[model samples]
Target: MGSSLSTPGASNANDRPAVAATLPPAGCPMHRKLEDATANVSPPPSAETNIDPRNNIPSLSQNPAYGQTIALPLERMRSSIPRTLSDLSTASEHESASTCPMARGGPSRTTEETKDTWVYPSPQQFYNALVRKGWETPVQAIPVMVDIHNWMNEAVWQEVLRWERRYFNPKQSNLALEPEEIPEVSLARFQGRPQDLSPKARFHMLLGRIFPNVYSELPPFDRHDWMVRRDGWGAEEQDKLHRYVIDYYSGADDEDGNPVFHFDVRPAIDDLDSLTARLQEWARIKRETWLGEEQSSITKDAKINN
Candidate 1:
């Protein structure tokens, strides 16, 4: 409902280390290592780097519906500014594969787990990701950045859940009540083509420029194609690798002075069924939204006539 993952009760973004499903809290050797690094390092001044321009305009009260013209299959979720890592549980866990020490955040709920549900990365991993990308980030700010990164991933997965609703709960009846029906959709593994622009993204760029007012959103800060598996569906659909597109967009800071971010998440139209579902989902939402508006207009007209 909210535009960004930073919204109240939502988590921040990005992928990190993988560990066992249940992580231990405190007394973790890895946790201590991370703390030691933080204390020892007299890092550069912390600043919000790697930022993208966001719209200063106020966000809509509810999620915006992509009208009939936009045929792409996409669902969006917003996150409010990220909280500090300390605000999270101090829990620690087994050492991750990072050469550098790092702490563990929450466990992921994605359907696929190469080595159990991957835990969000610690400050160390966050730092590594930035440096690996050639961004000169301050070590002192890694903790906060990690929290934001990890929370963004959580937000992206939430959008995946909205798409899975069609697969898991085709009935579209009582979706709010049927939490168990929705499948856990998480990043099975990163496909690693960050440089390549997805088809959906290219279309967004072309269309956005053509109609600046209608599609004026900024280009995604990052794009990830997640390979997910659906084993329960029938033979044709079963075990098929469905690639999902996640477009991360950073928005203007919220009233709290924390950056607002949005993820445009949806499944690629790899197959006929998926393509149909994408259009169907958009039509469903558009119709529902338009119906409400129409009903309100009719009521107002009647009152005015009276």
Candidate 2:
């Protein structure tokens, strides 16, 4: 059925020319008057004006340092100069909300989403960089080397004394031999804080307090007793070897290009690898024999000066 409505003019004579010439085609809903269709359409640019999007993009070549802004974290990491005290202080205030960094905070950004790249320390180059930057010796700051030596000596004597007392104590029997009690005494100071101790000292003390007699058989600590092999052939062996180095051979180095401290204190034997294996086996056994361990505030030679 066609529309019964007609234009509001004298067109009822049916002699009016077909409106298709001036109106939208029949059944074409989308067709609009040309004037209305073009009201919002922008006028075409002149021949002199270029409107291509590719041409309109701002030119980056205008910037003198385009694409050269380096990341502060990456910059600091790539350069091994030990961060300064001021840097640490600034870092402490950087983002207190974070507890993400494994090592004491160097710097941090409050985000779990980041592009992280690990910087494997190149010992010689790193130290050299530190020297160039005038980094203070760790002894002045952390006393890692000195305290490690001191802790080892103190540990040996404490264990020896404990064993002596235990051996002669009236407490005797098969059950007593494997008694469920471990002696844990700090030989550092009477009231000295263990947390205030150096890195190496702290490490030893924690392990000592945790496992007293387990490390008693740990042969006398000597700096030169064991040599850490850098690596072995094959990726699997190399990964194992790298992990061993990271575990035992700390990053601290002497000017002679040698490790300052050695935790893998394997005694000199025909085969060091075999000796280390034996020590691990002995440690595992001692660990199994251990019972409840505790920390006591007992010092070796602390005297109150009043």
Candidate 3:
């Protein structure tokens, strides 16, 4: 169910061009319309996938959907496994590490624009993670896979920022926030909850049954809960941690034969203030875009009559 962005064989170099046009504007959340529009282009299913918490590698697990069973002998698989850090190959010494992003600190390493940028795992560490997960991945593919893993993380962070901006820059929000207030937003941590359904899933399922055609998309291929810390409010709201949910969805293939994907990112309904802020943001956009256009059209007609 994972997109080429997360899957092993789906090369990022080949897939990105096809979906580049579908990407959202700077800091804006992905437009949900792509969910159905690209549904028919989904790539053929690969392995049943869930991300590794450490490096976010799209893990390959035993699934008949892959159509190929693990055939390597247990002894053969264990033979090449590095037992210690010293045994691991130095990524910098190899060519695979050249184009790939390193685990360097700061925003330069990731799509994040703040000091709290995400760090990509080193190629050696990424390989170690695959071995630990017992995946039958080829050594040559680690560079490509690691590239995709890091790219997906950036995509996830972008999704989170869409929600964070509402609170981080509340003055622009429709909510009644003080004009002087500026919140310092930082990522506290990331928690993978692949097995658990987010609270919103139940409500979506209920709605799907009522209107199957409207909400016919499958359950999220993967889910993540991210904790974001916000500070600099007033005494009443010192430092606060807001939880956000990211749902990964795969759609039909793109022109390059790579699967397209959508990341549904939003603040979890756990915080009443956040939920209210989200609704207000939606309302603000509706007024400024759809209703505002209608009003402008009416005014033009009246002026012409005069």
Q: Rate the local accuracy (lDDT) of all candidates.
A: 0.39, 0.23, 0.41
Tens digits of per-residue lDDT for model 3 on 1-306? 111121111122221112222321111112232333222222333466443332244432222212223232111011111111111111222121111122322212222223333345454444433343333444454544554545555555544544455454544632243535534555655555656776655555566677776553256556777666655545554445677776655555556555555555567778677667556545544454456433222111110000
- In model 3, the runs with Cα more than 4 Å from the true position are 1-116, 167-171, 174-182, 235-237, 281-306
lDDT of 1 at 210: 80
Between prediction 1 and prediction 2, which has the larger TM-score? 1
TM-score of each: 0.55, 0.17, 0.52
Ranking of all candidate structures by their lDDT, best first: 3, 1, 2
> Comparing 1 and 3 by lDDT, which wins?
3
Instruction: Tell me how many residue pairs clash in candidate 1.
Output: 23
Q: TM-score for model 3? A: 0.52
Better-scoring candidate (TM-score), 1 or 3: 1
Winner by TM-score? 1
C-alpha root-mean-square deviation, each candidate: 17.1, 36.4, 15.1
